[model samples]
Target chain A: MKIREVTLSTTPNAEAVADLRLGDIIYLDGLIYTAREGVYMRALEQKANIPMELPSQSAANFHCSPAAVIREDGSFDLGAVTATASFRFAKWLPEWMAKTGARLIIGKGGMSSKDYNEYFVPNGAVYLSTVGYGTGALLGRGVETVEAVHWHEELGIAQAMWVIRARRMGPFIVASNLQGECLFERENAKISENLDRVYEGTKPAVLKRYGETDDRSDEVIG
Target chain B: MISLDLIQTTAETLMDKAAIEIPQDYLDGLRAAAATEDGDLSSFVLQAMLENYEAAKEDRRAMCGDTGVPRWFVKMGNDARVEGGFVALEAALRRATANATTGVPLRPNRVHPLWRTDHNNNVGIGAPEIEYGFEPEGEWMDLITVHKGGLFGTDYRMLFPSDGIEGIKRFYLDSLVAFGKRGLACQPAIIGIGLGGSKDTCMVLGKRASVLRTVGSRNSDPKIAAMEDEFKELGNSIGMGAMGFVGKNMVIDCNIEVGYCHTGGMQMSVHAFCLSSRRAVARIFPDGRVEHRTDPNWFTDYQRRETIEWDPAREAAE
Candidate 1:
């Protein structure tokens, strides 16, 4: 399908997401949150029930803003900013999902199949990753500072939330999703096959020197 | 002698906010893409560019590497003359260039090709690569200097001549496939390409063209943009999928640069970099005036190529 960019200028959040596919590049502009990984993990350690008003659904997006997504007009209503990373909360996500109704996790990649299966469907959350090291490109999208970052003073850069304006925030693929349809598997199948081929063809001399006979050949060719 | 403070502070400020003035067309193509594009990676990549802007503002760091190698595009007025010395004025400008290197910790970029030794990354040896043009009629001289970033080191790759392929897109797709086959995507990187020059220069121009782009800039020519559009479509159609996972699309954006080429015998090549295509560009004015075009109309909405001929069923019915 055409890469989708829907302007989710809904009630509590005015965010946009790319109608994501297996592959597409996205740049987000407009408001988002920054969930420092260290601070969030600490929250989990304390068994803290940090609160929010607009807790997300499996379909909603997680943004990197300093402020919680709030009523467009500003009231008690708020939205759950996606955690910075999903696996960063591997231990915490299952419990967090049961309570919060948060669906989206946006950051860099890497999540296990088990994580994708459990909390994702039960809690209706999807894990998304932002572009890696494209900080400069992301900055060009512009930032709207809504809330000054707030956290326990000692928390330092961790745990503080600053609502921001994200530009082109998505079109991010959930390499792993509640549904078995994973972006990671489809993308890497060809690669894995090719690697197996190379390994199987490894030279006998090279394998002897490295003490690395091909395991792939024994499994497949045999 | 030019005062020490003047040299230090002026070049410092100029280096920062240097890429800000790039035409919106460039940024509009790649950066502004945030506003459009449906693919997840496309939006995310666009977001990363947006962050570049934010960091520049918060830290007040140059948007992308001191607006790249600072050199003035000068048009001197007939009446304009130095009061004390021409060489001294140029020398003072040179000194300011010296201070910029330390202040920015800019990569030691420039080196002689023949001698192959390091030059202080100075605007020396015509290093800033100055070009002078006097208006045939006008009195006022216009000087614009751009600081091009030096994103050199190991990221260089070459595009093969088309081998009778249709256009640049095939070359780009081939590069992405090769990179995937090599496991380069395990790290974050973008493929940068330059086409139409000689084997070496064409590749160099590709990398350099990326610098011309603001953190998220795109090619200006409509034809090039169309090719980019086609590139994305072909990529997605092939099912490489995001992260090579689901769809045919593997690349976030296949940025390509081209010089004029023959209609019958177009030369195309590839340069793929793993995830971090760290790039930046800048400009400087001889009179200390500078600006960059921040946006441009670069890529168009993803368009499936229009079917040229009527379908067999439709033809039969007609």
Candidate 2:
């Protein structure tokens, strides 16, 4: 199958986001920013002023921390770029999208369809999952330069907000679309159809832990 | 005595190599998987990862940004000695870890668990865990560095003796399917299983089985080796490929490590070494001859010795 690929701006228009389909590959341009628990807690919870102008400067919020460092002379030596799992950040995402007008939520795993329907669709946002999940070097090649890093002193490099200029920085898969459909969930349903056959000879453990589910289709993430 | 300077410098080089270079054994396994993978999305992911490795090598950058938590495994020959005692050697390893964190421009991934303080050097209390193993003879020391991603793709369970191979199979499938969803565990990985040890040792054995052993290597016991082959085939049959898409390449290989446990209880652990499977090894002699290679050769006969004494002739005969 010839997978569709598209180039999009970090600050994309509604039409562009609406045009995205589940499983479509994306290459991003313009400005993008990295934020995870540190940026969200500081901005949404502690009420620290957000460093960059959100949505205006960039609508793409990447759940990432690049392998980068600042030299003694105060220049950046940025290397591979990749994303962390996004499911853990679900709590703060709704507030973050409302606060920053984020259009693209890019990360490791896409969130649930419930997440996309409840807030992402309403906010005109969608989820883009990093491909291979280990394609950091490839993604790094797309990064033009590190524009700036915020809150490194306070939150450390892993959690700090890193603003970067992306030339064609991606191979992200459209994991969620404007209609709140989830690509991962759709794929899971297909794979689950054969779980019974694969697990035919296996027997449950004699001792079971509390809160353990035997259901093969149940996802560990919320 | 091996030079302290050589140990430290070699460790630094190992860190860089582990981060930037994908091991040949793993590369070969992945290529084999890519060739057999028929799922479109899964095939695309495999191809992209292949290209990612080349990009990392050409650019001298880390294969993955997470870079996992960097740790050291030191295996020494009985006759080998360090320039300084083990304390000084540990200090040198710690220094190398910190220096490489900035020099290689690695993300300073370590931090205070509660306070969330960042040393920005990947060094902190109990950070860069240094584990040691010793061999029977030879005046050489081996340094192995593994940068494995910390989160997801690992689990432990307590089972009774009644929970036989069938039970083991059940838990294995559970771990693969659970973390395999959405590619959380990073499928097409080296799946390691630890059995028969105490809870803690079970985790350690499984972890080592995943990161220490090379792809296609098998357990010494023919029975366990057969199980490894069967597990590898079973994992691939799950119909889930990379990113949990419908595919046929969930596991690149399966490794099982076992230890003697209490007769009443059986402890099990599962671990996945993901696509980047970053590991590098070097053997340094007392004369300062250093040999670098991808295979760690960690689980030698001495390591898996079942007898009370080191009887090489007896082991060889057996």
Candidate 3:
């Protein structure tokens, strides 16, 4: 059997950001955003601008950080983590990316998991994590600038949004875009395929529903 | 067979101890989660837990500064007799709490629900809430706590899912969303999953579960444990790794809890405690003995409470 080969599109950031070839694994070393609960929901309801924030010490010590890592696994660089587990305003992720042009995302703690498959897959953004109490590391880095997160002033804590020049961030990749060159998609697709197959191969469940044998005698002749 | 008074006393001691420490099983749970990890996010979370565990024990530090609301589990000996029943038990516990606080000063984290007020001493009218369960074999108590000396964050998302086992994942997830929405950063994170029981109990269980899960121990329940692993895997997949450090892990621990299943009429009621998923546990036995559980997994941490010797006649020996 002869199998034809196909090639994907290329981008200038590909080599610099180690961006995946829409299918190849690549390590990313660049700036990313952080967002969590309050900021997200408010944005969804009020359509307010907000920035992503990393987990604070309390959340870090208690909850896992919302980030992921990416590395090449053969020809593809699949994401290990996805969007933050605590999804806030994930619906606007595409819009956020459209505005920022930041191809990579760094949150996956609170958002509903399926958001990736639904919205993120269609968008160019890739999600991942650095979960588990990395509050100090997130904050200690030198900041370059920040965006709309400032609106929530009364809400004080460590897990806030800001963009900064990370000194030497590395081996970054977790859940990521499965739709294009991202590795998360492929892995997820593969798993889903296998699961589907298994589900198909299994026999039907033996139990009949409770109402299947309802007595016709009770029904009116009509 | 231990006496019922001994059991009640154990519960008293448990509450006092809980007010001051985090357990090791929780640390191990976070670490074990790294297996499903795919990047720096997962690794960083594991590392933070390890460091936190070290800091809490070696430096006598609290695992989490929040040191949340306090709760206890009293497993009484059915055959055993209480000198004066719950009244005596509660009185002794109150004394123990006061005595322990005078020196240990467990964080005063309880607040009046309606008034939104605080007592600051970690001791209020109903602080260190306790639950009584009579086990046929012997008397023992598991005092669990999360109380802080002062109220910290006041945001709604800051402490959602504060009630029960009803929808814990949603609560924790909501908290995560709030953190992002509020733009709080450098979050010293600790994850807790309160399962089983009604609202209040479930939340308390959540805090306890968080601190109790070892750095890398899986939940024994295959279904729930698998979910925990899946959560870590999915979280790591996102690359919210290492303090959202672009390569750090999104989570370190996914603490869990399992409550008693509802049995009969009025099935509407369910109770549980929060799993304050974090690292470090300081297990102090009845005879003033201290044993720390660092890992998040339930059984390990190289610790067991030493038996407290009881003189049959010397009740006043101190």
Candidate 4:
């Protein structure tokens, strides 16, 4: 069970992304930018100009908000970079990917296989899930510097687009690959095999909530 | 009287400690889990988290990027008094929260629900919620700060008495499996269950059980304590580990906190304290002496008193 670990550039090439297998650990170098809901809405819906030159400046779109601040002297102090759940951002990914030419979608949880097949595979993008649901300090150590922050005034710190220069940043798992296979789903299928045995003695609640599913195999997320 | 300056400064320190330090009890529980975790991916995650804890301490940075929502649980002895009263005490806590937001560089996570305004200081209306408790005696106050992740790994259900213990087990499993997938709930967490209180109190009890109580600590009730042990084993048997990978460790420990509810209904809530499990505590004496520790020691006998009167001597004698 020795897991293969690889180092990747933020602006990864097609062969690099295609070569990534599900479950391989990744360490990224080069530039990475934080972009979640705020950045999505502003760039996709509001038609606002993207602050950084995408794909050229960096192709890695990180779904994160670093524990960070701007000092009175207007310098940045960033710590513990971690990812948010990526499933919630599915709606805007296709458009964002096409527009930004992003090759890496890094975040907390991996997207569904359908999401991978639909746009991620077609766009030559793969999902990288942050290990430990975080390893914020370890990830923070990889940050060479906080290059810049965008939309702090309009979007606030949590949703601001933080551009960071990463030296060897990560411990991200290749949760999805060019083949549209999801590591999480593969693991989920294996775990679900024993659910009934673990739940043998338990009985369903007398009063069930609406829309509740007794299917242990089904994911809570879409 | 506990000086306002001391309270604020201690609170600021607690915030930093809570953010950066993995409480010892939780760290121990996690280490135990890591030892038994067989799944390769899951075991890797556990090891990385262990190293991350040391990195956070050495660098004085948050252990996790999502620092969670910071809140306070204030406990004071009946004889204890603050220098400027409770209003000023609250102001001091708020000031500390805002200061730490910048000082520790915590993400200013608070915002208006509808308007989505960020003060960039983790402070806003009803932000950094301050809940209070009073002990029967002593002239000291305890400040406990917990920075729990805001989203995922918590749920509430209304079950009638007829639902029985089997029903309770079902819902508990439901919560764990639901959030445990893809490590959304941050498995190997301290799972907290609240049973039999009003809906709000049930939520509060569950939350307190998860964040306030230390790992490996149990309920005062022997019967409930047994259930806690059973639930811990039950959770780990789920064949799921960190990030929903197949593994042997899903729960580090399980804690159940109960409150009396209506005769006809049983309200239940479940909460997970997450991988980082950030919490810090300090007890300040009226003499200006302050003590810092990891354990909150919140669920004392007085907190779970069953009778109408506060008579610790009689209870002890019994």
Candidate 5:
């Protein structure tokens, strides 16, 4: 698999993301903004404001709710911040991407694999699936700082928008890429084919045990 | 009578432990999975999970940000006495969960679904749900806590009699495949299958199987054990890998729990728990002896112990 490094900035280099492919590995560094289902929906309705000045199709956004605590000393104690499923906001993602100018979407499970071509490819965006349970590792070494930007009270500590600085924050799989390829769909189809082959191989034996002839048309005849 | 303070403290400690410590069975299962991974991505992902466990434990942090809903399975003794009674016990648990929001520092997961209102402390009406089981003879109360991701990667379904065994198999495979396509999003899940009960009972059993049962433990009934074995192998064969990359093992294990149905229809449910199966059990005796148990054993007759050494350096070398 190909590997690429991404750095989120106000003027993100679009060329750096143009050659991204499905199943490639990405190590994201630099600045990132956090958002979840609420932020996207609220932003689309024009009710909420995105605090960061993100460049179109060059910014990396994490779909997460963080367990962050502000200490009495004024420093932030970052807790486990996990990915909310991408497809949960399926209908709004295309618009969110277009409006927010987010180029890289980091989440778990790929965004509705069925519509990757429609939602991601045209926008020069990609969906990367992070290691689901690696929250501790990410919070420990990846993230350097986190500051609440907007919706801190309404969205709680986790689902709120936060500006963060990260260092090698990810080694995510490119579930969907700019080339319109989707790793999640490809992998599922392969597994389904193998499962079908197993079912077919076991059908005759199961039928024989029930004292039924393996004529292959019992259900069809019925 | 058990003091209310004891109950509150126990609940707080248990939630904190559950959030920080990745259960031994979970770590063991992941180590075994890493050892057998056929693809580089799977191995890398599995190893990262192990490292996440160490990092959480060392840093005193929540293992997964989605510390999940606070679910308590309370086994109460028939003759046990409490200072505040059941009402007080429930209240204490609720307070304990909200308090742990900072101690275990659980993510504030409780929210008003429609308006997106934050409750801040994970406490709400019918929140921190307690499933009580009364034992006729016992002097101690056992509280088993499971922090399950309530929103993401949860599934339930009902089947008509016509659906039959073939239908059950199809449902199991179809869900796993769908979840797999989503990538280890919930990949390498410990699947809990509940067959032949009302929808609610089936969901309860499914949750118990996934969160309580030890990773490699089996159902005592021969049929269910065989079914578990078959599905475990079949799930791994799908090769959804560690994080849904192409690999040998999609599931760490499968646990199937069953109950007699009404003979009219079957309510089969599957609870998918991500590799981070976070849970902790605490037992409080009448004599004031408090013991913490890592093995949940919600269905099995006896508790079994499996010591797992999640050595990141060793795994990295492998």
Candidate 6:
């Protein structure tokens, strides 16, 4: 519930982020790297070195594709920046968290509980989910500079590795914390239970509303 | 005759408007949802989203980082004459897309899938995809462009005739549960359900429902409209909240579009659009009068929802 401001480097320990609880908003200040499917897949395949020295503690890799216009002077206009979903990167989360020392992986759409329990919880990391539509808010964090360290040509500006200096950059929720607790999963569990009960309670009303009474077995619902 | 230059100019205007402005209907829907939302945090999140939208307008920047793939729905006049014909119309849109990548300052999202080549511009093979609906007698073109951002999760299923209505509802609920987690798929989601069609038709219909249709619209068939109402109530009961938290509202609306399928089997596609729900539409008359609209009115016959309260004990007794 409280806003916690934390500074992260590319070499801090994951224990720095372990105590952050789910749903707590945090403002991240430091060097945060950006990557997506291509860079991460290529890194795993070639065993190539990642682009930045990320903080081991609050080491965050945002699944973002920034709408940045690089000026002739090599400065970025820093237009829109939003999180890409993490579902596609499901299988690689464990390796990504371990290898990159990314104790905090920020993106939308929660990751699988398996990945959370196996990798994030045990590794002292958390998966934070921010609003994917909050491009202006994300850009409001004050991006000082952008340096593309790797994979620019392959993935273009959107999917390449860009080391960015962000000041008070994030207002993201701890979607899944280090203790294997996930806010999304917990909420979904409640919803799922509610769904069953609601379905049972509402089926007759629904059928009647659609004019598909039990006696009229041949009538299609829609 | 509509000149190629006009087409090009109109396309440019459409792209910019679509990128820069969140439609009035969508804004109104968000405000209503926020006001009605019972969850404290979720309501705050909705308000914050509204603020984010205003910020986007003030900054003249994209509302979201992902501009998404552009989905164009064009309804052309039957007797309309064009200087360069249909091909020219498509080319103009493509050029507009390319220019808008930097002009609207859209993030270059279209890429060569196989070679992993970034186009720099959003135009590429099958990029900025367009769908056409022609009128028998008219002199204007109604163009509606919707952004298919990343937050809308994709779904498709093949069902035997046996699957029926219960099966369809089950598939929909399951998909919602899977994609609507952690605000990942983005909630107060607007779902588009396409049923009883070929695979592609179902998919397109689903996408149309998700993006093209207005939030408060419904199907003409009373049965289908009733189904929409039920899904909306059931989806809200799940309590996915604003950003996948525990709350009262999950989906603000559900639009179902159905097509007749062969006797053997049926294909269904479910597409979910996030709360942003970005779209803009422009219509050009014969005399060269261009009217831009926030609502495309994709659903021709929109039936309003009846006011009703949830009754648990009545259902429990039944």
In angstroms and one decimal each, the interface RMSD of every candidate reads: 13.0, 0.8, 16.1, 0.7, 5.6, 6.1
Mind giving the per-residue lDDT tens digits that candidate 3 earns over B95-170? Answer: 6554443333333344466653444434577766655544334333333333321221111111222222223333
| Least accurate 10 contiguous residues by lDDT in model 1 chain B | B296-305
**Which of the predicted structures, 4 or 5, would earn the higher DockQ when compared with the native?**
4
lDDT of 2 at B145: 94
lDDT per model vs. reference = 0.41, 0.93, 0.37, 0.93, 0.71, 0.70
Candidate 2: tens digits of C-alpha lDDT, residues B42-105: 8989999999999999999998988889999999999999998899999999999999998887
What would the per-residue lDDT of candidate 4 be over residues A163-202, giving only the tens digit for each residue?
9999999899999999999999999999999999988988
Tens digit of lDDT per residue, candidate 1, span B49-132? 455555545654434322335664444444544434455545655665555544443423454556434444445467765445
Candidate 3: what's its TM-score on chain B?
A: 0.56
lDDT at residue B232 of model 6 (Cα atoms): 86
lDDT of 6 at B280: 81
Q: How accurate locally is residue A65 in candidate 5, as Cα lDDT from 0 to 100?
A: 71
List the candidate numbers ranked by DockQ, top first. Answer: 2, 4, 5, 6, 1, 3
Poorly placed runs, candidate 5 (over 4 Å): A1-11, A56-58, A70-75, A112-116, A133-136, A201-222, B152-154, B160-163, B300-318
TM-score of each: 0.41, 0.99, 0.41, 0.99, 0.86, 0.84
TM-score of chain A of 3: 0.43
Q: Ten residues in a row with the worst lDDT in model 3 chain A?
A: A57-66
Error of model 1, residue A28, in angstroms: 10
Error of 1 at B252 (Å): 11
TM-score per candidate for chain A alone? 0.61, 0.99, 0.43, 0.98, 0.78, 0.77
Clashing pairs in 4: B188-B250
lDDT of 3 at B224: 76
